[model samples]
Target chain A: MATFDSENAAHLHRELHSHLPSDPALRVKTLESLAIERGLVAPQTVDAWVEAYSEHIGPKRGAQVVARAWLDADFHARLLEDAAEAIKDLGFQGSATGHLKAVANTDRQHNMVVCTLCSCYPFSILGMSPSWYKSAEYRARAVREPRQVLSEFGVALADDVAVRVWDSTAELRYLVVPQRPAGTQGWSEEALAAIVTRNSMIGTQRDLPLEAS
Target chain B: MDAIHDLGGMQGFGPIPIATGDKDFAALADWEKRMWGLARSGVAQGVTIDWFRHGLERMVPSDYLSFAYFNKWCANYLMLMLDHGSITLEDVKRGHLLAKEAEAAPKSIDDVLASNAQANISFEGACDTPPAFAAGDAVRTLRIPPPGAHTRLPRYARGVEGRILAHHGAHAVPERGAEGKKDYQALYTVAFSAADLWGPEADPRDDVTLDLWEAYLVPA
Candidate 1:
């Protein structure tokens, strides 16, 4: 449960592993201060961009899309046909969404996403890719041993269901539309959106539970 | 050919560590934020993502693994700015802009965000040749490593057999993209059985699909 920011600092300090000549923090601070002090960028502009990513964009935006798709058949159709345009309906458009392709999970097929080479996620929509998603372990095991990896994430798939691991190695970002849970046929979009976790949307965990266990 | 960044199937790295909530960024020191902002600013100044990535790839393996992610971003941004003539080494070393000619016009917040959106262009580059593989066609990735300093193809995916899932049209070749070339190559999602990729230890019902370019594939 360690944040990459905190954990990475520890990693940087691990002299046994790191060969850094000085604290990386000092180097970055020097560069960042220089960039702002010299007017290469304004402090306010950087703050705004960070605020946009941390607050404006996130799994909730994705949950809204998922919930609407579950409620309206046509919206679901649109989502499958052209995800980039469909997502734009909710006013979520940006760099990370370059040609998004949504793959729905069904009774017979399950979808999971990983970027083995690098963390090429739709950050503009899904917020920051989780630190784990960027970890060397998740990147390596997600593709080579997905079922095992999923099990570690607490997703136990049925043996008969085929699991599709999408290695997002290009500009195409994937959104896994997990199967709608049973007994939620008439739920409101707001109600459904409450249950969709970021993990479920990424296919590492199951869709929102029907009534919170 | 195989870099530390190519971590797939490598052992010893343990389970994923999970961190919840918005506090993730709170862990960022002020410098990391500046590093990120500077990189985005570079992008706004017309530096291509592929080109920036190529700059990061140019890092020596030790530095690649040792430097924190944002530190890598900082180092690469400095190198690219110097290489692209956006800034001189004196500007970086002195921690201030020394030349009137070196100053890049500061972009507004809206302009920065808009430029970020525009950078996410869809597949628009032209392809002079027809696609070499079709959906449902069996194809095997060539065992060759990427010819350049950077590539999207992971090491584990090479020499594997898989079925073409879809033809995503001719797109700018990633290898060429890294080299600042606008060349096009056929791209497809090829699906390999987990068992095929990892032997019987893998689940029989699982398939791993990767988006690979035409230059990386051949008849199975």
Candidate 2:
């Protein structure tokens, strides 16, 4: 696990904190202390919430959904038809995914998801959004120059393959079902899921590696 | 408020960070984790998600632009706590609880989980009113400024003509929900061609789809 040293975090540490003169780390401590002191929330509850998102809920859930869809035509159809309801079959439907929509990748069309208004994502299924997905650069350029953005993510789609960018402007969240990698026939769902990278499900990576990582 | 938070289609930021896969939630600094937990716990305690977002949107443009994502969240949490009279500025400055008598009974882990679960029930629901547009209908998003400070309509999508790809049954309308009203409206996935939104220079084959409330659209 890496520390919070992303460019945005570094920029905030250097620039914003200098001007504000109050450390966000200290402020968070104060807030947590206050919350605990006020009996509004317990320390165990906070730890539990963190554990649930960090360990229990994440892209692994989305990967299982994708892997299942790839193996089961009926589940795939249901996923594309009503993802919110379909995910319930695997007990993966919850917050941030109550109104889920699944967009599949094909030779003709590529799908990507972004939230221009804010960092809206299917957190319940895909876990916390990557730092880049929440960055201003992604949110702004994704809708206007998706091909360029996709290329930056190393996914260079051919000119004819249409790109569809889904801006989550409402409660409805999206899950991009990346095209299954070829030559992986007769693979177990677990094996397939192991190779389903989070970025692939987020539509940044178009192709999955053949072997589980 | 049309603010810096609505970042669709504007320019001059920079390239997105390289794809390194999703970061582990546990990788976050302890303070960041606490910030996340506090914000979610705050939502569990009745600070509606809409309200929390509205608070973030209300941030000063400079702060909204400069602060890290969780930093903005921390600021919003403090602002909401202040608004809810749960904390005082002095208490924040002092770094501890100043009003001990005001403390409510501490919530157990189970209580917090239950509350969060209750707060996060599926937003999908049956709509009493029928959808005004069908899947194949052509519609133009309303160009007018939103009636409230919070709206899901991005500046780029407004006034653009798009085809309804699908109708998502009624969901909480953010404009009304931001103000603490329980309002549901028909939402649709409207697909706008790149040529339509970004002009002819953009590839005609590509399109952007947005799940927009009916209130943000009109029949073309």
Candidate 3:
């Protein structure tokens, strides 16, 4: 179809979000169209486009690391104790855990994350942040009432488990490192990665599965 | 903690900002010649062998540095240009490729942002204010588990109510803000004595103020 640059690209990108669909898949299509319109798909722009795509789709090579850690205890403890080191074990690359402690989601208290100030996420593990993750709305509200924010995501927590909202401060940014879900008793990395949506890695998603049409 | 640049809040209170927009490339060619805190010809502390320390402090009230991220996005785009040999930092300074810098010399970083390509966002039914709180009021953080969100309420501070300190401006809603066109919604700061948000183990005199919105407080 139409591509960006020359003149009309900015107009297309400016309009892409205006009517974004609720369906994540549909949203991805919308972004792709915008990228094309913006001339982001030119052969010269392939790297940038690939980078954008990876940011959205290629994330969770980090989650796969987390999943493997869930399968192994010594690794799990190491991950909880020192996320940077634990992550290095998986040969993943990122910036958030270099100085700060990376907290893992547990059975006791389900965890969520956000860069209320900005969109500082673990792109190494989770890939590109979902469009919502970068928006100012989530950034501002995620910190104010984390529970309510999670509720909007359809994640309702029971009263017992305490919530600890962590900020990805300048000293050290944070990553949720969500717990692996059940049902896939002996799934491999590929299978798990398929189900391990980017939202799950960011802590905005929950265990609920999408119903089949 | 600190503002992105040194000299604190004021951008051009004392020093007249030199135009680093175009002439910087030639100046940077002699960057190694300039003694910017380095003892002699060596690299400054806190920098890698190749990277020099600019000694800038990037900070704001909110958690992540949006400006830094924005700068990062710009820098990456520039790097992409560099990789393709599309333009040099000198070209960037010369106002050759940049649509924004072609104007008068940018006085400061803010000036640069003003000059460059701008992207504006529109919010639908966006609530800029969540009423029911004021500065110097007492409040507490609700202890609700996050199903799937990256939140800021520390576990140690759960159910811990803090007093409302200076109400920072309303932040954009992040869920929508994440869409990237500047969705900084409304937000407020709730102050908690480090002792209260933490515990008796914390310093009673030390206060811990958090930038929060009305949704977190249940009229504590």
Could you say which candidate leads in DockQ? Answer: 2
Per-residue C-alpha lDDT of model 3 across residues B55-103, encoded as one tens digit per residue: 1111121312332222322332332233333434444333333332222
lDDT of 2 by residue, B104-188 (tens): 4446656654554444366666668988999999999999756876788888988999999998788888877677667788989
TM-score of chain A of 2: 0.89
**How do the residues A1-213 of candidate 2 rate in per-residue lDDT, one tens digit apiece?**
111112322333233333433677977777788788877877777777787777777889999999999999999999999898898888777677777889999999999999998998887788888888988888899999998898898887876799999998887888999998988899999998999988898898997878665
Model 3 TM-score relative to the real fold? 0.44
Q: What is the lDDT of every predicted structure here?
A: 0.71, 0.79, 0.42
Sort candidate 1 into its docking category: acceptable
* TM per prediction: 0.87, 0.90, 0.44
Q: Cα deviation in Å at residue B111, candidate 3? A: 34
Error of 3 at A199 (Å): 1.7
Off by over 4 Å in 2: A1-21, B19-22, B101-120, B124-128
For every model in order, the TM-score on chain A comes to 0.86, 0.89, 0.67
Docking verdict class for candidate 2? acceptable
- Write down the TM-score for model 1: 0.87
Candidate with maximal TM-score: 2
Scored by lDDT, the top model is 2
